[model samples]
Target: MLDDFDRVLAQARRGSPEAFQSLHGDLVRPVAAYLRNKGVTEIEDVTSDVFLAVFTGLGGFTGGQAAFRSWVFTIAHHRIADHWRREARAPALVELTLDDDGGTTPAAEHHALDALGTARVHELLDTLTPDQREVLLLRIVADLTLEQTAEVLGKPAGAVKSLQHRGLAALRKIVEPEGVSP
Candidate 1:
């Protein structure tokens, strides 16, 4: 399946419409999900921007599939950075209170509790700087190796390891304040 993507990307670089369509179909959902996970509310808009940038920059790719994926994500990272810069002047987000309305009884409370736990994980991730988050996601979620993550972020492997270590430590502080000694 990925081999097909490589072929499509090559064709896309030559301005092939069919290849572009194939690539869009392959990537749109994952890209949107990635953006949403990164706290981009207008995921569709940003996803479109990422693809547009990918299509425009396809000619610049000098490596294979891994490199291409990294290139696409690098574009995504830049777009996310731009979004943050534009919104930097805006007010910060205030954490919301979760009150159980009578509609959600004890049974529903369990589900809500689970959701709250998951939300806490995401909230913790939100605390990291973008570079740290990017390296963390690429290493953990995307299951890329440290070397691959470094290549994607255009950073050294040692730097990627340092960021990952710091990011995980921060996540541990949020997820397990009792300490990881156990």
Candidate 2:
């Protein structure tokens, strides 16, 4: 993916739709998944906004894949914050309930999510404290560095490190059986 990105990112920056599509294929799921974990209900809408920002600002950006990744995620993180702010300002709209024949059923969603292994991941992640989950998601899922995750969470690098270490230990204990050894 990194190797393909050199030429692809260059082409995307130049307004090549194919190149941008390729880049989107690589990034969209992770970005959307991260947003979903952060409780963004309209994941696709926010993901689209993030990509629009990325493409619009792509020409001015100069970086390798890691930098591009961080940049993209930075945009996504800000979008989540914006979503939160909007929600805080908005009044209650409607309540949604799941139905078997409805657009999105719990069983259907669960089955679909299971195919992506997201349900299991969610199950494991649900056991974590919010701070531990955030650190793990930013570092492991988003592929952010300790410094990057720290910046995102407004914590010191040492704090991020400790969170990560403790998060992993908790996950290990939860996932592993009593007879299993590390």
Candidate 3:
């Protein structure tokens, strides 16, 4: 899959519509999932924006598949931050309440989230700083090597490694409260 991604990115760089489509198809779900985890309820709209940013910025790209994915995610991070800022400045909306008739409400979203590990894992991920979260996601979820993650983030490999270490340590604290074995 990684090799295919490299080929698709190379072809897409040369302006192959089919290759770009293939790449988009491959990436949309994961990217959307990442955004959704970031608290963006409008996943479809944000996903569209992310892809549009990717397409527009593709010409300036100078790395391989890993780099490309990182770059796309970088754009997404910025977009999420922008959305946060906008929301912060906006006036608060009135809260609406609905009466509950003692019927069992649906199971918590956390219940179904174990497919990605425990809901606790996702909660721990949210505890990481943005830089740490980005490096961890790109490395673990996207399966990019440290060097590749660095390339995508436009950072040195050492920095990516440091971030990954810190992020993993944080996750370990949550996952293994007894403490990590040496």
Candidate 4:
């Protein structure tokens, strides 16, 4: 599967619908979930916009899978920012649910504890500043490295690191109120 990297990218860049769908399969869930974390109301819509921008710009894109992933996420970040600018307010916290994009909850096999844990993560993330929240989500949620996260945020690596450190500390404070000293 990995060996077809060049073929997939070349075809997708050339406007091959099937290749685009193939790329979407790898990225859709994670990207939508990231937008949801950003409090994006129309997650699927924004996600589609992200992919559209990517496909349109693919002719100019260079590099392999890692670079492609970073570029797509950078587009996602920009789209979320645009959404906020239109709303004229920072993203607000919503009641985090354990529902999937299909708006369905997990089945009986999944524990209530798991759902609560998912809600707990969103709750904790909600406490951080927007910059910190974005950094944490880019790193932990999007699974981007520090460099990639920095690129997405248009911040220096040091700034990204600082935000991540502060974000983690804040989460620790909430999770372990007294045990860990500041």
Question: How high is the lDDT of residue 138 in model 3?
Answer: 72
Write down the RMSD of all candidates, one decimal each: 5.7, 4.3, 4.7, 6.2
Tell me the tens digit of each residue's lDDT in model 4 across 15-79: 78889888888888889989988888788788989988988898999998888888989999899
Worst 10 residues of 1 by lDDT: 173-182
What value of lDDT does candidate 3 attain over all alpha carbons?
Answer: 0.77
lDDT of each: 0.78, 0.85, 0.77, 0.85
Model 2 CA lDDT for position 176: 78
lDDT of 1 by residue, 1-182 (tens): 26677778778888899998887776676667677677776788888999999988888778877677777777887888877776787787887867855564569789999889769768877899877888877776555678778977889999999999988887777757656441
lDDT-best of 2 and 3:
2
* Candidate 1 segments whose C-alpha is farther than 4 A from its true place: 88-118, 126-131, 169-182
lDDT of 2 by residue, 33-91 (tens): 89988878889999999999999999888878887887888899899989999989999
Query: Compared to the true structure, candidate 4 yields what TM-score?
Result: 0.76
Query: Which candidate number maximizes TM-score?
Result: 4
TM-score of 3: 0.67
Better of 1 and 3 by TM-score: 1
lDDT of 3 by residue, 34-77 (tens): 77666776678888888888887777887766667767777876
